[model samples]
Target: MTASTEGATDTAATTDSGPTSLDTGSETGHQTTAGGDTDGSKPDLGAAPDEHCANPGPWPLPEAPLLELPRFVAHSYIDLDQIGWMTKFRSSVGHDYSDAFERCRSMKHYAYPIDEVDWGAVELYAPVAGEVIVVEQERYGSRVQLRSTLHPEIDFVLFHVDLMGPLAPGATIAAGELLGTHYGDQTYSDIAAATTVDGAWRLISWFELMTDDLLAVLQARGGISSPSDIIITQAERDAMALCCTNGQFDDPEELSDWVPLDAGNLAQPTRLGLATLDDDDGRLR
Candidate 1:
């Protein structure tokens, strides 16, 4: 996750603590500001009430689809334990997986069953119309990690990838463009509090402002209705259900807050920093 410059200061006093002063002088010449005073004379910065600080206000939601249609369809969802809690909360709050699986099974569309691995070739495509933000070529022994800024308000993260070579940063890409391929042993692991059926590996990706629209879609589709319901498969549903039931998912509010706006529609690429996988080698365990 990238850092935001809005709240980057060190000594900005919050409502709960009042104005905080930073001493630039030596230890012997240290000075202090009273909790209420910005200057020595004024009782406060004339700052708004505490509620202003407590509730930053509702975040703006995107109108049109932030990401292009036919987005890179994952054969399965990333195991819940591999991502932040908010992602898990988003998946759980809007949908019931077990019930969805039963419904899918009744309809005989359960080709991708739990306890089985998706050995089928995994496809990779761009999530939005933007440039490559960052690409890490050597992180996972030929795997590449791509980060792109789809819009001024949204950042997209694609990992567990196998690319041809290093993609220059700032190279623009259209939505649904072939970004890379998926590579790894087609088995998952059962470590770090995440559940695994037999041995199917999971992948990790991050999204900023793009989630609200995705959530809205999932909600409209009855929250993970089935493996073939939309983007997720049956195995993915079972894995998330198990992870949520076992307390492996992160907090919902935090995840919801991290979503950014899908403005700008920028197409820039950045360098991949550290690659965070479920296990050390992008395997289950």
Candidate 2:
């Protein structure tokens, strides 16, 4: 639900208190480009024996993170604007990654935590220094895409933002620079990254490329303790049954689409987060 729709209160409502579950409907035509494995039949979910599964390259790729992880939000916790409670990968609380890159792909990208702060109180910043290749203006807001200067294949994406500068295909951007203000009505920031592989864009959590110091900031502000605590591996996510309907990638169900953020309690009977979750008990939808 990070990509705010104009009026989807029915499906995008805050049924509970963690992150808003989504109902993409036709509003997400912009993000409908999930390729590689969208044949309606769910992936093996096991070890992904087939070859079509997404290929996640080495972590912290070289020339990677050409710049430090830029701060996306400008709010401070000392001011009572609690900007925490972000959902990790394979957790469908943001956009639907039900059918991401390849069979073994986790369509999910990280949603930067911005809970309880005024909508535009937080300013957005570029997390990487690269060349702007795509700048899109949508009904709700603007989105920008940048390719790494060092590694052209790796792309950094930011959605649901009102761009700050005159960005075009050939423009250059430095990490930590102001991208724009937090647009729309959602509580968090959305960043879904991908890499070009075999003529297709394969989903890859950009945070996986973060330096140790960068990840430490995530651990300090949110409920995260370790890298594994946040990232939902293919096997772990499949076991949780956090999937979407055959063709419905946007209309996320409470249990089916979203994964719980209980960092260490993977096998707990019920899932929990920083705040109290609804009594839904997280039954597989």
Candidate 3:
């Protein structure tokens, strides 16, 4: 039913261009079963010129997304030293500073502060193909919202971004497409995953959605054994009290001296629903 775009079938161009086009060759979606082939017969993929291949990225939509860092570098400030999940922080209104110990609370949130890194030259890639939802300009950058194509139930927001081009509603986005360029001397952004519950959109813990493989990749690049070592705990809070009168480690680097907790116990498993977490077929990694 879906028409194949011109040059879409060319494997060489597809690889060079990063699969900007989707192949709609079969009416039932030309995907193979877990085994080599359903009938135990290998599908003829011609040669490199005529080969047909599936898009590389996440699987079964976005349950356990294969995420690329905002920047192309294997590692960035997003390293274990800068990321935080389930950490207690002061809630401020209108960007006003508040008491850290008295106003601190724990909520599911992820923060990556790439303040020292130069991201102005890097292109931001769309984590998934989705419709543009909201666009807002901020002091340091622009905030763009996209309705996830993989999961209509979830909404994704990218803060502190400079869009590559104008993206209006109803426009189709391709996975791995360059959404925009990030520009800033001191840049930081939060990628939040929200879902509607009881008719209201609430922030959900994405820490669990981060797959073990991805975590290992990050850990290797971050020069740490586990990403979970960054998760703040009551003991970390006590350590902060020893240094600061207010008991707050405003700079994440302050906690670098603390020992990394048992990563295996801290990591939350992926929540599987309609989608699966299998890449054993060696087709979708």
Candidate 4:
């Protein structure tokens, strides 16, 4: 599907800490068109994807309540190769397949499933503590972008979502603060995060960062661990390997703040970065 924009009022909010920083030293430039629509008429900053899924695996609904931590699923690059997480497609029907995939990869688009039975507009919370920088509206849709003050180079953009109650292009928002919700039959929303590097916006993979964060929290959520248990399953390793690709990540061990599954009986090492949103004074530790 295509992207459009709508109008919104500006507001302000406090910021929080996540690994929101980006390597701003790259030479590529990124731009988002007004109304969040980019077509053949505009210069190609990069082709953005529709969604990112971070859920480790699906859960039986009746048993979901028994799960300690929330399961993550967002828009992610579809692994056509079936061998790893990164996209290896080199050709398509007629378009520049490799180029398009790379562009989509760079954007790190996130798509989460909406409850079809009760899926309508609901409030969106600030994923980070940051200030509103740009609110763009077009004839068909709208977008709001935020820049984390704590990590000035990191930016978050919510697409096809409306703003409500006096929000606009210059507001500051606290992490988990309310933003308006979807107003139509759409099943999902899109969120794109990037960091400005060398004057260009570089997208970071949200899967590793998000999954690792959830792992940290879940490790402490329940009392279900054995001193000799194998923490990192082979499936989890493949998923992590797939989620991180290109120059984005060479080794999962090198990923920042990542908690290794096997750490020699280190009790809940992942929880090291777990912190409450209200505890804004501390970083995700």
Best by TM-score: 2
Per-residue lDDT of 1-285 in model 2, one digit per residue for the tens? 343332121122232211123322211111122222666543333332222323321111111112233323221111123333345665645333422122222344433333345656567777767787667664445657676665555666666577766778778877677777766453244565555333323456555666666666655554556656556766565455332222222233333333223334233212222111111111000
Candidate 2: stretches off by over 4 Å: 1-82, 98-106, 110-116, 186-188, 242-285
lDDT of 1 by residue, 1-285 (tens): 221122111121223312111111001111224343455543433322111222221111111112232233321223221211112212322111111001101100101112233322344566556555445443432322223333322233444455545666667766667755544433211111111111111122232123455544433433342222222333453343212211112223122212111223122112111112222221111
C-alpha lDDT (0 to 100) for residue 232 of candidate 3: 42
In angstroms, give how far residue 239 of model 4 lies from its true place: 16
What's the C-alpha lDDT at position 272 in model 4?
22
Residue 59 in model 3: lDDT: 16
For each candidate, give its TM-score against the true structure. Answer: 0.33, 0.57, 0.44, 0.41
- The model with the greater lDDT, 1 or 2, is 2
Task: Provide the lDDT at 81 for model 3.
Answer: 38
Query: Would you list the C-alpha lDDT of every candidate in the order shown?
Result: 0.27, 0.43, 0.35, 0.33
lDDT of model number 4: 0.33
**After superposition, which runs of candidate 3 have C-alpha atoms over 4 Å from their true positions?**
1-116, 222-227, 230-285
lDDT of 3 at 245: 14
What's the C-alpha lDDT at position 109 in model 4? 30
Cα lDDT of model 4 by residue, 98-212, tens digit: 1101221223232222223222344555666678876665222355677665655566666555566667756898766767764333323445555433332334433333444
Tell me how many clashing residue pairs each candidate has: 23, 2, 1, 37
